[model samples]
Target: MNGKQDLSKVSVLLVEDEAFMRRLIQRMLEDLGVGEIVLAQDGGEAVQYILNNSYAFTLILLDLEMPRVNGFEVLKYLRSAPDVGNHDLPVVILTGHAEKERVVQAVQYGIHGYLVKPVSKADLISKINRAMTKPPIDASHLK
Candidate 1:
């Protein structure tokens, strides 16, 4: 994916537990020309937001660990919930570790890509473009 592609139409739902990391990524996305960015402090907040407006965002950047609802649970809800209007919504995991096991597990839930912590602007652009342009993963089996 080209790092220069315009992203003025993209909207992202960013769900992270840490305040600092959330702010950092939000700034990165803003600098990248993303049209809208919604912040969710944790996975629980993300779930509630999704329940009410699942189709509003173009993509989701989700942290794997949290206090109450984890990224895995949010992924499950997004992929399997009967009420969600857009089951194929693109998701990218945001994790501190890139362990093979963890990445593999996230793949089962149909994550588009992942970013290691302290994400670079270039890597962020690439992943977002790749995720948005790729065909949606079929998660009907999650139902």
Candidate 2:
């Protein structure tokens, strides 16, 4: 059923303010055999990391609530980057937020997937794998 998410070469970027959450997600991604994981504390760092780095990451796990910059803003920025919106870069909004508005807003911002907080290793790993193997959205829909 196309469940074989070939993620052997996937690189990940995790943006979260909480240290524990960040570490937990990192470990979970590692367990999934995802190659290369980087952490960013805020939207600014996330933006800088993507800009400074030459290779585009396979996925980005963004937290909704962050200081200085938020997930929505970061998603918007990433989509606006040259050759990025159409690129097969998956971004998942993983946070504690459950509001319908927040979820809708995230979807509108062009992320690949969304997962609620307190996520277990199984859930986290599965979501990331799905993002890697699944096809990305159209570029026109991103803006």
* Per-candidate TM-score against the hidden true structure: 0.90, 0.83
Clashes (N, CA, C under 3 Å) per candidate: 0, 0
Question: In candidate 1, residue 13 scores what lDDT?
Answer: 94
Clashing pairs in 1: none
- Best-fitting candidate, measured by TM-score? 1
Cα displacement (Å) at residue 92, model 2: 0.4
TM-score of 2: 0.83
| Runs with alpha carbons beyond 4 Å of true place in candidate 1 | 136-143
Per-residue lDDT of 28-94 in model 2, one digit per residue for the tens? 7777677788899888998888786575687899998998998888888887768443434688888
**Model 1 C-alpha lDDT versus the unseen true structure:** 0.87
lDDT of 1 by residue, 22-85 (tens): 9999999998889999999988899888887544889999999888899999999999999887
**Pairs with backbone N, CA or C atoms under 3 Å apart (clashes), candidate 2:** none
Q: What is the Å distance of residue 87 in model 2 from its true position?
A: 5.5
